[model samples]
Target chain A: MILLSLLGISILVALIMAFIGDWRFAPEVNIGGSLLTFIVSLVLALQVYHEGGSISGSTYFFVDYLNISLVVLTTLVSTTTAVFSRRYMRVEREHGRVGHWRMRFYHAMFQLFIFAMLIALVTNNFGVLWISMELATLATVLLVSLYRTPTAIEAAWKYFILCGVGIAQALFGTVLLYFAAERVLGAGGNALLWTNLSRVCAQLDPTVMRLAFVFLMVGYGTKAGLVPLHNWLPDAHSEGPTPVSAVLSGLLLNIALYALIRCKALVDGSLGSGFAGNIMMGFGLFSLLTAAFSMLRQKDIKRLFAYSSIEHMGIATFAFGLGGPIATFGGVLHMIVHSLAKSATFFSVGHAAQMHGTQEMAHIRGLIRGNPAVGWGMFLGVMALAGMPPFGIFTSEFLILTATMKDAPYLAPLLLLGLTVAFAALFRKVQPMVAGLIPSGQKQLSAANIPVFLHLALVLILGIYLPGFLANWFHLAVEILK
Target chain B: MAHTLAAQINSLLAALILLSAFALLAQRKIMGLVHIFAWQGFFLALSTAVIGFASGEHHLYISSLLTLGMKVFLLPYILYSLVHKLKIHRDIEAVVNIPTTMLLGIVLVVFSYHLTAPIRELSNLMTRSTLAVALATVMLGLLMMVTRRHAVTQILGFLAMENGLFFAATSATYGMPMVVELGVALDLLIAAFIFGIFFFHINTTFDSLDVDQMAKLKETD
Candidate 1:
């Protein structure tokens, strides 16, 4: 009942905001609704923690240790984004860059995007998952092009076409999955349900499931921002509103990976050949290398962080592909920490861009002099992201690296190579920005840093001492994956 | 006798569908491509109805009606108006020449047949033989998308690819669940509307419908 209300209230508020046409009240509604949803998510997470297993609510909705963790993560980040956008969008509006109508549209569509992602998370049916994911894509496409610049439109266009094609392949793969399951479960709703399909996963036709897994990998992998299929990620991230970029890096990519892992569970159960893991490992390493190298050439601050997201996703994917209890645990932990640190980075970047009056890294010099809070916030976030000690990201990356060394010794060197290059590239770029002489004609702008500091503080606490309940959740999630 | 007759008609319809895919690749005019696309949708709807009738799957009847309503009547009409509004030129810009694309289409048909041979051997459904045709049509649509420089042609190719997937589902597994079918149909309609809006924006911003002109977002050093 709580889950249903959460989804329901989100959609209802979205519709209300969409039709209200009053920009003044839109942010309040957006923030209020998202806060309530976040509280509900925390309640659900506690329920799962104490109850210690799957909680079923009818046929369409269910919560388990695996997804409850993601549900909580998603809601937390979304609530922060809502708070962050309040200050950010106001600044945008004051500059006449955003009018009343655009603000209303942004508020409405932002809520809808959250609703779509929550729907994707809660649905028991794979078909519904695909539909919700498409909804998420469409909603974000609109948000990405909100500026309506030539470049923004170009970014939105590429995003729609590439992801549209990739998702179509996923649909075909889903049909193939249904076909494989239908032979055993017979035709009906039960044939497509994840719970029923996973129950009978072993009996599915291997050949058909093999083909279907390939399609699902390519399809969902595109959305997850895996390279070779990730041509749209950087462009979409850099061009959209900074808060939207934070959501994309912190939440949407994670949701896509969650979907892919769900499919991977089914495919692994059916084949037992380890082919899925091998393919994932191959893609993961390639993406890690590609993203790490590409970061060296980035001039746009947002694009730099966007490439870092690709690198982190690559590491998470590689960890999961390694497929041990330790590796899975590390992967799950990495996802949580990455979302926190990356969103904080974007929040700081948003304020920094606003202060410097440009997104070009070359022009935004001496951030510590112009504004200490934004400069230090970005520096700490980047340090956490670079896997420095006493940060949550370091703990997760360390675990991932150790697990890789234990299982695939040869691959560990490549992982090290990617991480070192990425770390160096980020440091070289950020050092000058944070510590250099203040650039000429720079003006300091007072902006809210509450969300940024809040995220970083949580990440810091996670690094020092992970809560017992959260650790237990990660372990349970890993077991579910195996 | 009835089984043989139904199989013969299914084979003939499948052939016509494949021929239409080829014709779409060969056409050089935007208006001509739209016409060929409509014809392909017509053959797809006909093939689907025939297969549904022969197999006695009642929901496929509804599926065929959807294909007819959306593909044959609605989408083509929308595309037609989109072209008119954009004042698009008649020439359908191709990144690759006509003969080469046609040749690639043929090669894809051969590859799909080779790929589906084992699956065909395993299945006993009446629509089994058309599985290769369905796959080939999908591949050809992808090829068309890769070879076209114009936004309209790429959209056409995408729709054509959806048509192929629908046919594949009907032939391979007697179509997806009715709910999924309806949802996909709705998605197609929504995507078309979105693309229509996008086309106008692209034209106004870049002053050309050629996608190559919108390549201003490159990685900077």
Candidate 2:
């Protein structure tokens, strides 16, 4: 019942938003839809907790401890971002940056994007997963170009072409996966179902499985913002509206990693050689180091956080690659905390950008003096992102570090270096902006600080004390992964 | 005898598909690139039909029809109207010289063959031999994207790559599940519509379709 509601509400909301999206109350409708979805997801979490295993709602949808938590996280962040977009986009209209048509388009596409993500998360079919991921991309490409500026168009174009080509490779990989499964499952739709494949994965051809995993890694890794294919990540995140950036950083990257990790489990089962895990670790560590260093050079505040997203995803990916109970636990925790903190930072950054009328960090001055609410919000959010103590990120990062030290002792120093560099880079840019002299005649916008503080408060609570149920949830998910 | 005949027709279609991928890489006129892409789609449909007949999988026939309609008729029409409306009839310049691009294409073909050797050795399917050609076509399409400068040509390269993947699906496993094939076809249609919208947006914003002009988004000092 919860599964059907989750899908029904998203589709119904998308349709309703498409028709009435230009109206003044459209933002409220968007918020209502997201809130309803969040509530439904919480119900899903409760059901999964009570059930204590995977639930096959049908042949089409599957829910387990792993995705139930992610579903709740996705809907929660989306709801908060919806609220933030209400205030932020209104200010944008006053500046004549977006008119009614674009606003309608934005609202409709936001719901569709969420729908695509929800489908991607719950679908039992790998083919459906691929299609929904592409749907998410198509829905967001126009959103990225919403301002219709030259640079916005360029960013959207680059995002479309790069992700288009990269995702095509993933289709090929999916084809390869089906090819390997066809023999074992006797050539039909049953071959593409994840549940069936996992049960019989050992009987699947290892050579074909290995090739398929490599293609799946590159294809999904591109979406996950891994290095070498990560050029589109910063441009898409920075150029889009701040709410889009929030979800792109906080939620979309996790979905891409989720797809990759799901496929890795099958490959690991078939090969029994840790081949998939090693490849993930290599890409993970490389992305971590590269993005950490890249963060220092960013002039745009959103881009700085965008690169930090890549760094954190790299850490999660690396943790999952370690392929043991401890590291996988750390990885899952990192995903949750990073999503909360990063989206909160984008919320603060969005309001800060509006106040100063720029995204360039150099021109903005004295955030605290200008508006204390937004300033302190930005400070705490960035601190959380930088993995400082007393924040949830610190706990997750600490767990990952210890896991790395115990398992891959040689790689610990490199991880420490990346984390340190990212820490310094964030503080150096963020401190002055928060504390320096207030620029004269800076008009304070009525900012939305609730979402920002709400997210941070949750992160703080998780940092100090993780409840037993959530811990049990993570442990169960890790078992499923192994 | 019927099985051998079907395999023969399949290989011939595969060879034609690969030739068009090469043609796409070497074609300079935007109109010519679109024509080559259409021909590539036709050959892919033909190959899918032949594979279906040989394997007795009725779903491949539907996939073939979908490909023919979307790739051969609808997508090309969209591309044609876009080219005509945009009035970009100028010859496209390759980033690398044509000869160098062709040499690279040849190298990629060889690499694909080597990559698929193990699979060919293990599989017993009639379409197994064409697997290398499918992979080669994919790589060639990627090469086309890299070498071409025009936005239209890059899109053509992308479409050609999708054709290659479809061919791979048909040749490797006869076809994916009917539902997946339909979903993929729908995605292709949506993607084409989006690409069309973007072309106008790109043209209006930058006043040109040269992807090179879109360099304002890099990092700063």
The best candidate in terms of TM-score = 2
* C-alpha-based local distance difference test score of model 1: 0.87
Q: Give the winner by DockQ.
A: 2
Task: Give lDDT per model, in order.
Answer: 0.87, 0.91
lDDT of 1 by residue, B11-99 (tens): 89889989989988887799998988998898889888888888888788898999899999999999998898888846656555788
Compose the digit string of candidate 2's lDDT tens values, residues A65-129. 99888999999999999999999999999999999888888998999999999999999999999
Lowest lDDT sum, 10 consecutive residues, model 1 chain A, at A20-29
Per-residue lDDT, model 1, residue A468, is 92
- Model 2 misplaced stretches (Cα beyond 4 Å): B90-96
DockQ of each: 0.63, 0.87
